[model samples]
Target: MNADELYPKRVRSQKSDARRNLSFASRRRNPNLRMCQLLHLQHLDASESKINGSSICNIRSVTSLNLCGCTNITDMRLIGICTLPQLTRLSISWCVNIKGHIIGCGMSNLTYLELRGCDGLRDVNLNDISALLHLEHLDLGNCNNITGASICNISTLTSLNLTGSGCITDKGLSGGLSTLRQLQKKKQVTGSCLHSMPSLRRLNVSRCWRVHDENLRQMSTLTKLRYLDLSGCAVTGSTLGSISTLTHLDLSRCWDVTDVGISALSTLPELQHLTLCNCQKILGATLCRLPALRVLNVSGCSQITDVMLRAICALPQLEHVDLSDCATIMT
Candidate 1:
């Protein structure tokens, strides 16, 4: 009897995927398959089943695993995945039932881990997770229960995404900054505040209602920052000014940000991807000044007109542009 069938269809599909994965793992008859060698596995809409953890143990060669939208999962199933000594990348976004630690001691080698939308997750021991020194990317989006204490330990992290993590505040981020010394050189630690992650390359704190630019400005110390998302944040023009090396900027849903803030982006000569979705105050003229711009999304910006579209087209590197929902544009 397939216990998975008795549950929702999502559960059934998760079990089916696990079965297929187990079958594939069983086929790898070559014992010479190097565990340290890189491997990539992407499974969309994965569900949780009792069989998944055991199947993960069989795929010793897998290094990167992306299981996006695996809502049917809880914590125990992912424990099996942690045992893989070479595993690095793992994305379990929208996996609602994953309430606690799935991989503790075994995740020492993990470089990238995304737990976005794991709403039920409330507790995570910072000490256990801080062991992963190789970590570069981590996403904790929409986990309202997580507090600042757990985040404080991950100072070695380079790329972090906390979009919609409502519970986080400057206090938690500040704690994280304080602990960064052991992970990087002393010069990398510039700001006395939370944003002082010196080696950081990508930072997404969008919709973190509690965070303000005062603490966020400390991120200017990270001279290598390439991507920054301040949408729905209290960030103003000065915040953008600090990050002059940014190549991608997303300021969507930022009602407080006006043309003055948009102008600050012009200082970023490397900027290529820009999203100004629903920010009505920025004028069409402001869009034309961006040099080296390629992908621009101005959806829901009613203030923009055909002139704004023409300005975007004038950019020699512009390859993709989206003006959807812009009421002022007729064609």
Candidate 2:
């Protein structure tokens, strides 16, 4: 009589049951049609699925949605997504069809948003996103159109990824990041100091060629930073001297950094993961000075021979070491 009562018998049948087979095929073709019945669904990962914007609107209770690599998604579909009142985390990475003016709607509960490689997204308005007071983690990596002003208002953000977003310049950091340092000082005076001085913990600006020494000087004020990636930027060893709070640092492809710059890292007592891939100038003298160093990536550092390897092996805490492409290292 009912669809549920008939499904069990249909599945057990060996005969060519046309009605039962058609029903199963229909459900497979339109998975969203069945998902609409699941009112309590909290997480939906319809990534790379044929599900369109209209189908997504049916799942109203979802809090986390990952539509990454869904090239078919458009700006109109994003409008439907805003209506989901419980949504807090959304990842639309590589969704190139999602263009301008798509974020300013009713996503007040959103805390984490990822728009990496969203090529169509241009002229994004920060005013729309500023309403999300709870927003913390944002990844605009490879979104070339993003400027500094677009993120200046989001002072509540803790983790930001801007890798390959070269349009962002020193002016952008001055406007947005400067406020974070001020907030940290205010929190310290109020005796609400948590783990570090600033709320920001992780930041990646790799391949952002416009970022230079002055920007690093400004970033040094974020005393709470534990993870920082400045690979492929225009900074020298002098910049490393400014930030002593960093634990995980990635300076891969930083050709300008020499042995003198490596010495500055000695001040970071809590340093652990250090990536110096392609830093050919470092001869490995300062490598042993890091007392807490655990993971070290010195791949492509041809200057590092057995002498450097000996110093690296002497570190009692060292666990993982990347000596790939080192011509002088014996075995």
- Residue 308 lDDT in candidate 2: 76
> How many steric clashes does model 1 contain?
0
Error of 2 at 104 (Å): 3.0
Candidate 1: Cα lDDT at 188: 16
Worst 10 residues of 1 by lDDT: 181-190
List model 2 lDDT by residue over 56-143, tens digit each. Answer: 6777777777777778888888899988998888888888888847685888899888877876665456567777888876777678
- Candidate 2: segments with Cα more than 4 A from true spot: 1-33, 69-72, 119-124, 177-198, 211-215
Write down the lDDT of every candidate, Cα atoms only.
Answer: 0.62, 0.69
Kindly list the per-residue Cα lDDT of model 1 for residues 1-331, writing each as its tens digit. 1112212122124644443232223224434543322133222123342223435555665555655565555577777777877676666767666675644568777877777777876646445667778776666767778765676676666655665666655545666543232121111112244444555665655665545556556667778778776676555555676777888888888777777777777777898999988887767686677878999998998888787688778988889998899988997
**Candidate 1 collision pairs:** none
